[model samples]
Target: MKKILLVALAFATVQFSSAQVETPQPSPASKMEQKVGLTDVTVNYSRPGVKGRTIFGDLVPYGKVWRTGANKNTTISFSDDVMIGGKELKAGEYALFTKPNAGSWDIYFYTDTNNWGAPRKWDDAKVALTTTAKVEKLPFNVETFMILITNIKTNGASLEFVWENVMVEVPFTVPTDKKAVANIEKVMAGPSANDYFDSATFYYDNGKDINKAKMWIEKAVELSDKPRFWYIHTQALIYKKAGDKKAAKKAAERSLALAKEAKYDAYIKKNEDLLKTL
Candidate 1:
């Protein structure tokens, strides 16, 4: 009985020890996210160490498609359309693959984002964007694979990859100013009812031109089927500023009725205050 009990206890202990053991990974996963202008850029990859081996032409053979990382295919995500290497790429996620050489590196953006490393048989039809970047030798050795977003500006940035003694940079541009200016021009050409109301309120508050304020506020009220309490209140204020107490009191009363129906306490109080002054 004692010998049987000892054998069972040893078996249980071995099972627990085996379950607790953890193996280390040779390459570890990493993620980077950045915002350039109004666009968001993200990268998911795995980092492999140098391990004292020649990287460029020996381990990661030259003139071959690399995973751009280790273990899994590297992925890059863009939130907005951008111009990369002077080629337009629509906003989306893509797998980053590369072909390295002594002089230049060819960077590929593939639509296939869920593959393990660079597949032996990758379809050329899956390639979305391809660009070439000049290879530059680094002054110091990088012990591990590194990816960086550098040279950040309001309209563009540079994506850099560094490993061992090799470095490559891919430049991209965002059309921030162009989009903003176009939107501004559009709004300026066609002013909405709210724009007229806001301009009237600005003019009335600043004591600029009472007649102009009245014209704009009237236009705002005319355009609205059911005028807002705030707009009616602004109309009352403009009348009061122009020294027309009767018209001001009438507009304030209308504003109070709308405020009560909407259950807006702040507008109700403002209308009451204006009426009291009249």
Candidate 2:
């Protein structure tokens, strides 16, 4: 019994020692996601507090590359291609690194995203983009590092980084105008059959000119190889509103036949109701 008790106690001690406990991190992981124009941008980093230390010159040290954030390297991801600092960056994830100075900061988007800290050996080949941003002093102190995307516009935004008493802004633009203009051109070129059908339906429902409604519905039917039952029903409604009883009855019968073939019970009932009205 004594041997068994000792073994059980030892096992309990091992179990206690092996148990994992959760605790707050000194520099906690953070994430930010924003959409600028048609591009989706995401940032993941760890925020380290100032903790009463001088950040720029003393701890971070100017004229040398620094990991943009704490612990694991900072990462920025873009869903679509973007123009930053007059250079185009392709859609992908990048490791963000910075070399700070008194007047300006050099920002680097590196292809390598798996580094723990600033890459020990600098490789120019790994750099996807390099840009410079002017630094500005803030009036008040900031306790922790922060990254903000602000000055949002339809096609661009400002990516700002703030820490201690300094801030830097990087301007980026997304190519949204090309796609927008293409869509506009496509829409201006011509309307689809569905567009014609919807226009006719709207005109008929709003008690507009019956002749115009009939004209649009006829175009819709001509566009469709085999017109839907709803299209024929809409034509019947337009004819009925125009006081053409024969034409209305003929269109309603066509709609009923198509509706029956499609096994559309609701449309079949609608046709039956419309025929009764005629």
Candidate 3:
């Protein structure tokens, strides 16, 4: 009986030792990542120490500019033109930096290529954009630096930043449809006109006003015969809508001729079929 009891005691001790020796599973960390633009350029970075640990002046140092976060310089690339910090940034990558304070912070955009360090040498930067942030009046400590984009719209967006007892917001605007249209028209009026014609066709396919569509197609037709098929097809549809059978037939024939020359056999066949009914 004594030997059996000793054997059971030894087994319990081994089980407790095994439990203590077991390796602990690591807790997952949330990394910052976002996507932007038509091609969906991915932006990713690590969020380092923030609130409870003490940042800026205590952990990060106040007077010096910080790289903002660790691992890869907090890159943001635009697939197209974007207005950031009230200034236009063309499609490219930029390194982010910040000047921190208790009340407000100055956000900076560095054009420097190497994103390894913070403000090592600002003289090499191409340009810098400054924006002010409004700090909150709360005593919550942040453990990780963070950024979020909210209230996104076609015309503009709000870029937000948060850390420790503060939050900053910057309003950013993208090119509006009206502005794009005006710019396209200006480009069309330039020396090489076909480029503009292509632009008009793009706008039309995207559901622009029919009257504007008709006007742009007319401009395309006047510029060169290269877009003749598109212009003729559009004019034929317009004529059909206006109940002008004679004009519709003429335009359809023109479209068929242009399509045939361009080896657009499918377009030629479709336009010819429509012409037969007229």
TM-score winner: 2
Question: Which consecutive 10 residues in model 1 have the weakest lDDT in total?
Answer: 16-25
Kindly report which residue pairs in candidate 3 clash with one another.
50-142, 50-143, 51-141, 51-142, 51-143
Give the Cα error of residue 243 in candidate 1, in Å: 32
lDDT, candidate 1, 1-278, per-residue tens: 99999999999999988886568778888999998877889999999999999999989999999999899899999988899987998999999999999999999999999989997788999998999999999899999998889998989999999999999999999877877788889788687779889999999989899999999998899877787889999999999998889999999999999999999999999999989999
Error of 1 at 137 (Å): 0.6
Question: Residue 68 lDDT in model 1?
Answer: 95
CA lDDT of every candidate: 0.92, 0.93, 0.66
Q: Which residue pairs overlap in candidate 2's backbone?
A: none
Ordered by lDDT, highest first, the candidates read 2, 1, 3
Error of 2 at 210 (Å): 32
Better of 1 and 2 by TM-score: 2
Model 2 regions more than 4 Å off: 182-278
Looking at model 2, residue 216 earns an lDDT score of 94
Q: Using Cα atoms with residue i matched to residue i, what is each candidate's TM-score against the true structure?
A: 0.62, 0.65, 0.50
Candidate 1 or 3, higher TM-score? 1
